[model samples]
Target: MTARPLWTSHEAQDATGGALVGPDWNANGVSIDSRSVAEGDLFVALRGPNFDGHAYVADALAKGAVAALVDTLPEFPAHNPSLIKVDETLAGLRALGIARREAVGATVIGLTGSVGKTTTKEMLATAFAALGATHASPGSLNNHWGVPLSLARMPHDVRYGVFEMGMNHAGEIADLTGMVRPHVALITTVAAAHIEFFGSVEAIADAKAEIFQGVEPGGTAVLPLDNPHYARLAAAARAAGVTRHITFGETAGADFLLKGVETGPEGLTVSAVAAGLPLTFHLNFFGKHQAVNALGALAAVHAAGGDIARAAAALEGLQPLKGRGGRRKIALAGGGELTLIDESYNASPAAVAAALGVLGAETPGTGGRRIAIIGDMLELGEQSAALHADLAGPAVANKIDTVHCCGPYAAYLWELLPAAMRGLRAPDSTVLARSLARELRAGDVVMVKGSLGSRMAKVVEVITSLASDGAA
Candidate 1:
């Protein structure tokens, strides 16, 4: 069966108030990147401070974009390129998103938090996909342009829409949520992820609560009951005219209560109570923090009128995303393989502690060592040094065999770590990646982690490259 077109030329022109040139064409998808534009896609020429998509308009068209949405016409090479000329491409994209949101009947869920927004959004999308056709934000596309781009990409007939909203400072989520107008607003938990911008976690909670501001009339709010800022978020929700609430956590009296969790080599077996009924499910991923994320996701699913049992069952198939606790086995040159846990995406103090806890639970192979390659946790403001130093306790408590610390902030952690647990300390990940790669041995379980700015993935890449090098 032929798929229905996402947008026709007429629809695009009406949505963006743009003048169309060349023959009418239908776009099955929308994209901002010229390099990844797929066949039958509507490419929007967005201008950023560092780069301009207008320069890539020809490339996008030649690559397979059915039509290009642009603020200014680009010079073409002896060909009539289909174009939608608008006053501003960014505004045009936002207009397209607004039109798409109004067109879909999907139950939209707006999610935000200091951490776990991407994981919970993925979980919600996976669970909802089991119930019906679902559309979710791709990766960490939870910012200003990401939110609208995700919305505009949603299929008209989707049954559920899960939009992840993120922020570095105040009021960011509010603007994104206004465009989403979700039926349910979910805040994973308030943490010190971006404490550099906000002086306190309370301020961060208030910023996250902005997700509730655009909740549709009679919409429900899903909150983390165990978080210290739960009350603040609830009050904020009420202030935003959202009265119904669903809370999830290990705390007593939570709407969705996490009763217990058992960790193993494969994943976590979670026991919880939803509303009043007992529930049990297995997540093919590690971390108690993830268990809480699951509860929040299930609560959002429930609030959105989805089947709780089905959603819970679907979680069993959910695995961790790359750079977020996903594990892989790297074959060593001499003999046995070593396990690699990729947590190199982003990190905060709480997130690092949680990762260490997961590391502690793993029973290593015979003669295997539990190794941690840690990069700096960014955006802590005045508390940066103290917070970095505080990780020493979790490392010690978790019984990590060796720790490779990178970045200047991580040096504070290195200084605080016990002499026996210290492996290597470098000024940056690039320096540490080389030494860490050469030091890896058979039967070792290594976990790499850092904030995006820290470039910790380079270490993970260097370590994984051993497999090919060994083969060669």
Candidate 2:
């Protein structure tokens, strides 16, 4: 039996309003990167800031792509038989994604917040996996080109689609969410991330509330009840004509209330009541913040007319994502081991505090001290230094023993640390890695965190490299 196809040249041409220049062909999926293209995939030649995909169309074709969508015709037109030409490629891609979205008629969930957007999206995708084939935004593909690219790649047969909508400025989410037109919209939590652009937390909250602008008629709005801006968000949702709002968190009267949370290094035990239905589930992930992220997932599922119990059941096997919250044990040069919690993907004040809290609850193997290595949380504008310095109090409260700081902003945190607790401070992550390598030893529990621009993952690589490079 032949498998169902995602798109055909005729269908794609109709959807994108583009002209087919060659024989009809079918695509199993869509990809923008030639390096990532699989057999039978549609390769989209998109113009990017640094590189143009048109330069790689032949490369994509050579890689077994079923068809190529390009604004520019290839040099060897007479030789190519699977090319489609469009006025503009990116817009055509968006049109194709929208056409597929409309045709599938799947329940869509759009997630946005300062933090946990990707995590919650993944969790929701996992929950939706119980019902049928589910598709979600890959990684943190919550921005302009990423959203449409992800949408265009969605398999037409998927029962549910989850997309993460992110923005650094106002109006961005509005445009992306409008394309999504989600049946369920969720705000994980309004935070100070990208505050440099928004100016104030309230403004960030206001901007985040824009996700509700695209909620379909009779759709659901899921919000965090524990956030101080809950009322503001609720009002915004109502203004968008969304009557049913599901609030999740520890706050009283929350539609999805957390009754209790016990988070250890290995996993979490959570008891919650969602819409008056109580559920106690064990998740294979830790941290209070993670618990709330899971709650948002369940609330999103319930909002989409799915069973919360089945969604809750899916949480048991949740594994930590790399560069986000993965945990591992690295063998020391002199024997014994150390626990490493990798939060190296990105960082903000709230995220660091949550990571520290998770560290505080962990019992390091055999007489270990909790260590925290932090890099700059970028894009805070003028508040960068003050925000960095403010982390000292939380680090101390979490009982971090030795601390290392990297980047200019992180120096503020280094100075605020009590003299005795300060281990080292480096001008950049590269220098910080060298400084930390010398001091790391057996029986140490270390957590590394920084923003994406800070490139803190290099330190994680160096430390994990020690497992093989350093031994007794």
Candidate 3:
């Protein structure tokens, strides 16, 4: 079936308080970037600190956008371009998003957490798809502009909308959540993810709890019963006018509780209960942490009045995400095999520990060793060095045979490791990439993790190139 129109020229004008400058037109989608704009998309020209999107109005039109939202109209070609002229572009774009959300009429689930927001967003989107058409935040589009863009892109006919809200300082999630007004609000878990901006983990949990501010009347708030900040979050939710609450975790009193979970190199089987109904499903991704993430997803689905069993069934095809926990099996030159786990997107002390647990769960091939290549986890504030060194216990406990590390902060971990497990340490990723490439052997299981600033993906690339050949 042909998708319904997202915006009519009159509707766009009324929604954004802009004036239509050309012939009436229709948009099938909404976009901010010209390069990715679809044929019938409404491209919103945005202005930021570094760059101005208004400069690309002509480029967006050339890319086949049905209409463009511009503060200042650009010079057009022979044919006139459909345009919406407003006094300010960014505010106009946000107005359009709020208008879209009010019109879409889909059940919204808004989630926030220190880590796994993106992963859980993806999971919830997939689970909701089991019932009907679903729309979700793209990538990590959980910030100010990203949240608006995701909302503006929501289809009017969608059955469900899943949005991820992220924040560094306080009140950010509250501001973003006010616009979402989700029917079901969830907090994945609170950790010291952006501790640089906050003084304590309690402050972080308080910030995450802000998602409850937008809970619609009669909607439910999903909390993690296992987290230490549960009471604080629950109190905040009730104060925000959220009446119903559902908790998901392995701890007692959780409405959605995990009974047992078995994880393997390929995937994991989850045995749990959602609101007292037994649920047994398999996740395409590995990681014991994912079991909790899965429970959160199921809780959100159930709270949103979706088909829980069908949603669980849809999770069977969910695979490890790229730049998150993507896995690759490369045939070694010596007729053996090596597995690579890429967790090089973002990192924190908790995320690093979880990745180490995943690495430890898998058994290496015969005559092979378990290797971990790591880089710095940034934004740790005054406790950076101690937190970096804290990896010693988790790494050693995970049975990692060797470790290759890089970055200034990560040097603390290198110094803390025993001489037998210390493979190499470099100041940057470039030198470490070469050293790591040279160290890979057949039958090895290697896991790479670091913050985005560390560029650990380069190391994953080097190892991948060597995996196709003999030694690096």
TM-score of each: 0.98, 0.97, 0.97
Write down the lDDT that model 3 would get.
0.89
**C-alpha lDDT of residue 83 in model 3:** 94
Please list the C-alpha lDDT of all candidates, in the order they appear: 0.92, 0.88, 0.89
Native-to-model Cα distance after best TM-score fit, residue 128 in candidate 1, in Å: 0.2
| Model 2 spans with C-alpha error above 4 angstroms | 468-472
Alpha carbon lDDT at 291, candidate 1: 96
lDDT of 1 by residue, 1-472 (tens): 9888999999989999999999999999999999999999999999999999999999999899999999998878699999999999999999999999999999999999988989999999999999999999999998889999999999989999999999999999899999999999999989888899999998999899998889999999999999999999999999999999999999999999999999876898999999889999999989899999999999999998899999999999988888999999888767778999999999999899999998888878889999999999999999999999999999999999999999999999999999999989999999998787667888898999899999998998888888845441
Q: Which ranges of candidate 3 are over 4 A from the true structure?
A: 1-3, 77-79, 469-472
| Higher-TM-score candidate of 2 and 3 | 2
Rank by lDDT, highest first.
1, 3, 2
lDDT of 2 by residue, 125-209 (tens): 8989987789898888888888988888888788899999999999999999888989999999988899999889999998999
Q: Which pairs of residues collide in candidate 3?
A: none
The better-scoring model by lDDT among 1 and 2 is 1
Clashing residue pairs in candidate 1 are none
